[model samples]
Target chain A: MKKDLNITPLNTLSLVDKVEMRITQYIKDNNLSVGDTIPKELQFAEALGVSRTVIREALSRLRTIGIIDSKKHKGMVLSHPDFIQNFEKVIDTNLLEDETLKDIFELRLILEMGMVDVLFARKTKEDLKELEEIVDRMETNNSESTIFKLENEVAFHGKLYEMSGNKTLQRFQNLLLPVFQYVHEHKLPDAEPYKYSKKFTTHRELLNYLKEDDIKAFKKGLSNHLEPHLDRILEKSKS
Target chain B: MKKDLNITPLNTLSLVDKVEMRITQYIKDNNLSVGDTIPKELQFAEALGVSRTVIREALSRLRTIGIIDSKKHKGMVLSHPDFIQNFEKVIDTNLLEDETLKDIFELRLILEMGMVDVLFARKTKEDLKELEEIVDRMETNNSESTIFKLENEVAFHGKLYEMSGNKTLQRFQNLLLPVFQYVHEHKLPDAEPYKYSKKFTTHRELLNYLKEDDIKAFKKGLSNHLEPHLDRILEKSKS
Candidate 1:
């Protein structure tokens, strides 16, 4: 076995962390916009009393999160970090504990239910058509192969998230999709049996509710559609 | 004005990005858990056919997100990224566009509504007692100073999020708290007048609903509490 390296107790703050905090404060203090150029690395090093290497390391961290971008012509520009991209990197299903995964599962349900008002207000005719087509494809697949691909489920929900007209919320839903799918596929301990009965409302029914602009009916239909997973979580918790 | 540096068109993938992806994949493939020691930097450089500097840069990025922690004796250990900490770094209220901030405002509302089920299910007697005290504090402050500190409002809501028994959800609420506070303090464009009248359900009323395990009443009370902000958003969207 490899021996442990001689470790020192961690300081409450590391030099790199302090440098990162200083850089963030600089951006905020300057009120930098997406395309605004940040000061050069050497300037930051001098101002922060850190070495050029420390500044470079801090910049690399910022770039990793999409908060700052370095171009050949532009040294560093403030940019909106891709929250979804950063989240996707770390959301490996295998890496998460089961409780965390289940929490994500519940979060997805909450998001789907919570976005109904936006969906009713913001959905366009084209969005409806796209959703209808996805539901149609699901129906065809259900009848032909008697199997529904996970992508089909994701596509339908993804379309709804897009129609909600909240990009941040939509991105968050997309970020959680993988964990949602992982739970669905694995049927982890405490997962109830999938409800295959035809009595529950289908995607088409939910679409009809959406098309009618019936928020109540749509919420009802959605709750019915999501009941199996919700029931699984509820049942598991009770047991 | 700073002279533009000689810029090159960004490739779809940067070497650093590739290395980052490879490192993430390595962690997954190795099934590394929190506190598991990562392979040495030189070992990664040799395996990935990159220089040690590239490996160090990539590792720095991971450290920024809390995905890897390095200690003198421990070398590097895999760790769960603290989503809230990273988010706080980039969530500068002044830096965000007004639209994005508004979107966050709506997201907070959604989260609040969605958490009701979990709150009802998981809230303990002690949780109720704590919530009562917060509401009591607010009432006392309102009676004495005729003003509700924003901290009181946040404390009441924060307690509800905690009672939901979802750590991920609670952290998200905490992460978004700053943006929420920003909107509250600034009275952003389209914000409706804050209701000063005693006509609506008070926090104590909401607490009563929670005590009785009345989900419907709780939701109604919460909706009434949030109506001013919700009305503002809805009205703004119409125009």
Candidate 2:
């Protein structure tokens, strides 16, 4: 075939990206599901009119994202992309700008607050018991400190996400944890002192609302629980 | 140096994953920001006690995530990771399960509902003008359809995200779009018809709420707008 010198490669996407898109389109067009086998490199290269090297690069990108797994004998199989794998790859806290970190903290609040309906709709006795244990552990801490360790906070909230029975939402909560931890450890600029007033509801109060299936009260309690952190985010943004 | 028989690899993470993590740690430890040059492959391999090939593999993974860029004469440079690059690599609709798709649709609702406060807080006159144009277009569509086309729907909601002035949240909304499209096109297993009654508020009404800066009313309007889609997800879950 004669080279077409006049034709410019108008594609702004790199060859690897283009190939990746095509592979995804291929999977969709073929109605391929998880565990389904994908074509070999040579076959893909020939089918897509690209070189084997391009195919290999695209497949490597796919494999990195967990979209296609390579087994001992199987060439390549479609797989459910692990949310953590992709999320963790981009979540180097030090690399993220301060504003981005704050945005993530805000996102955490949004997700937790928006989860009220699902949490109430799906809470079970077992879920409630686990949450109660976490709250009780906080209450009985020998240190006599009302402040929660990061793990304690994560356990209580993580339990709530699990009870929501939405794996996708749970994954989002897990992904946001690192940012939350960063913010919690290093308070935002101009962060105000947390008010330890009698009116503030603890996890126990929130749990009571969940137990009673009072979503309205649960939302109010949850908001009260998250108020200190939310205030920091709002204050930081204002300044 | 002689190899010792008693020595075992203590790290459970794959060599590539470990190297990737170490490289990220290196960037953080050195306080490297976007456009900052990182050490060469040979330097990293020596520092991390790994082969150049392994370092290269790890760097490749980082580059795919946009955490690092390999520029001519610049070696590896730290860069901001593009959310879409990593997100697009995994968002194969065919590979996603039906329940996962529904979960994503639900996530869209959560994000939109959560956006109300921000939208009202940050919305500007220019934003209102643009939104009014979109709503006007929707009203004047030749089909005389109160129902929004997918593009129109995206424009209205996308504009709201933009007006919220949170780039991270906007990116998230953009990333969830494919799954939203999938759900909209394929409607859930037990999807119901949208009740387009005279009482149902349109985008125009939502705009009026925004113009009046009535977040409470806007939330109610937004909820009503998303009601049918939310109903489908809730209905599908019941089955």
Candidate 3:
């Protein structure tokens, strides 16, 4: 065998990045929990063998993300990270690329399709009734409008996510649903008319499949329901 | 309708929060993008009728999130906010509750199961061969091991996600996969010896499903493959 010379690439992480990893490590190593106090900056710097300035920058980033609670006597304390709030805070839609937005929008479609089992397992009679009502409104309000009534579209899909009963999935669904709306309003405009324009599945059809508990048919119908989006995104990418 | 009283909740957003929203809105309304300079602090203050201090705090928050490139000429310019970097930076594992962790862990399951179509559609022959090699390693590395070879488990699942060809989903998969590992190592231990011990679908079986191009079977198999994680999470929640 030839000599094994698998040289790795040089470390690309900045000092702050490495220091931040070390500090998060210290917390995990000590099994720290929310409201727990971490060591002062000097102690952390000394422990991690980094400069005080680097530790300070790392700590500051943590505080900015609401990871550190400075309000506890204005000292360093671990706190519950409000991710939903933090995600909302940092999300500047204009700064994101169209590809990033479409990827996120596609994530919603994937999640919706992935969640049919959860939906069927956990749905209640009232859930079905509400879904039907939303679809009824979608049909009533300008059914000839080529696409959809925005509010009803959200309600129909949001209701399905709610029925999934996975709190994590719901949180992600809430965060990502707006990306879909944004894509529909902005990037997906002026598309060639829907490819499956003849046989596109509506919200009501999806609800009926759910009501029958026919998961396979429901899944196929969802793929159809969301086909227009995929078609538009694919066409745009090809162009 | 006796005395229509459909009042909404009071506004809970603080001045800084409102100003941040306004600035983001201004960016969208003006179609400002990367490298574009935002209005100076005083200009924003005058336009929004907010104090310079409020504008300062809002801008500071934006800087912390990397939304505003403060270093470009030492003034504010729109920047591509690096979400993955920011997410990794802010994540403090010790502070997250088991419930939150489980929620995120469940997200991986949903995403993977949802991505069967992508994997099937996009997986190349080389992708399959590499997957087989990884599974072979797992097989050789003490196949009797009840849980998994941690590195191999990550490799197998990560490969599947890579095959999906969704950049957003892959980023999310990368971020959330570690959470899965964390849960597996931390919270999900001491699990009652695995519920599907008798009939669990291993990664090998999932590959076979893909090889046969049976999408529905592969989807069902992925659910079974991930069921152990869910079983444990549900069991803990119930108890």
Candidate 4:
């Protein structure tokens, strides 16, 4: 096991982590505005009291995360923040076991349920029209089989995500596609009643809520719409 | 913008991803059990039609993820199946942005809400005792300050995470702390209902529900507990 002792600063980290933390500290300490250009490599290393090799390793990670854009001739420029950078690493390390998967599963459910209020509040006419088209396409397909339902399923949920108008939530919903697939494939249950009947009812209600700007009723309807899925999910957890 | 056309695979990746995939595939293909020693790097690369560099990169990533263990002389031995291996590169890269943060926020909310059932279902006598102790300690403080409340707040919610019996969720809850701190610092409203009461009735109710094993009541109570924060979150989103 890797000991957690506080060793001397010289060779403390695995060279990579040491370098990475220095850059992180730089960003944090300098309060460098997003998109700011990072200091020159040799300068940064000198400032941090580390080697160029360490700085380079740290910068490589930052570049990977889109935090700093690196070019051949030019130095690093600050870019947008990226959260999936760490998530991807965690996943790549194959470290998230059954326990983590369950955590992710719960996360998906929470986001799905919480989105209703936002969806109704922010959805647009164009979004509603799109939903109608997706629902129409969905209605034309046979419902008994899941394979045929894949596209429509994504369409409906994707529309819901879009309606929520939270781009972050949308990306998260997309990222969870892998875990979602795993759960869906391994432990799928029958479509709850609301999934068929109330799906349209809730959609119409939600769209109307959006048009009318009924925040109170919208929240209620959102909760009601998600009630069935909550039950189904809880039941699955038990079994 | 990083045009997809501008993207090129890293030098180390060609051999790495394929080697990793092939190794996993070989294990499955050959029905190799855990503790199975993978073929020597060169031989394995030859069999999989790849270079040793690629195999090594793959092995390196896998090793990092804890899927396979490799020592100086022990060679590489298959470890447990880990799904999180997919996320290492993601984490290493700096791609999460505002949209992704929002997604993570919503995701955290979803996970928090979904955890209610898990909390109640899996609560033990000891768990309840520990929660009671934390709340009891929280009751001693009269401060409404976020920093002051943080200690107790984390304890109470951390207990909930533990009850969910999901380590990933627990670690994730910890991982997202900085983001949560950012939100609390920037967005949360400081309002009334704090001068007289400790304003943690919901936690008491949650404890009651956990003790009684009332899943419905527990969820309701938890939602009520979260409602204030959720309202503030929504309001913050607007502003």
Give the top-scoring candidate (lDDT): 1
- In Å, residue B172's CA in model 4 sits off its true spot by 1.8
Clashing pairs in 2: none
DockQ-best of 1 and 4: 1
Per-candidate TM-score against the hidden true structure: 0.85, 0.82, 0.82, 0.68
> For residues A1-239, what per-residue lDDT tens digits would candidate 3 score against the true structure?
33376663447567887787787787788888887888898998888888998888788767767778765465788887765555665454557777788777777878887777667767888988888988888878965564557667787888988987787688777887666778878877555674445877777889999899888899889988877776676556546
lDDT of each: 0.80, 0.78, 0.76, 0.64
The prediction achieving the highest TM-score against the true structure is 1
The sequence of per-residue lDDT tens digits that candidate 2 reaches over residues A119-236 is 6666789988889999988777736544455568788889988887888889888888887888777857644554545478878888898888897687667767877777676656
Candidate 2 segments whose C-alpha is farther than 4 A from its true place:
A1-36, A43-51, A142-149, A184-187, A193-198, B1-39, B43-51, B145-148, B192-201
**Can you list the residue pairs that collide in candidate 1?**
A5-B73, A6-B73, A7-B73, A72-B7, A73-B7
Candidate 4's residue-wise lDDT over B53-119, tens digit each? 6666566655544567764677877765444322333332333455555556555666687566456
Whole-model alpha-carbon lDDT for candidate 4: 0.64
TM-score of the A-chain for all models: 0.82, 0.81, 0.80, 0.72
Q: How much lDDT does candidate 2 score? A: 0.78
Please write out the lDDT profile of model 4 over residues A41-156, one tens digit for every residue: 89988887888876765675565444677655666777765545435444433334554565676667666755555565566788878877776666777565786688777777
Residue-by-residue lDDT tens digits, candidate 1, B1-239: 33376564568677877898899888888877887998999999999999998888888888877788887898998876765566666675255667778889889988887677777878999999999999888877875542456778889999999988888888888988888878766755644445435478888999999899898788778877887777677667777
Highest DockQ: which candidate? Answer: 3
Give, for candidate 1 chain B, the lowest lDDT window spanning 10 residues. Answer: B189-198
List candidate 1 stretches off by more than 4 Å.
Answer: A1-12, A29-37, A71-74, A92-94, A144-147, A190-198, B1-12, B29-39, B71-74, B92-94, B143-147, B184-187, B191-199
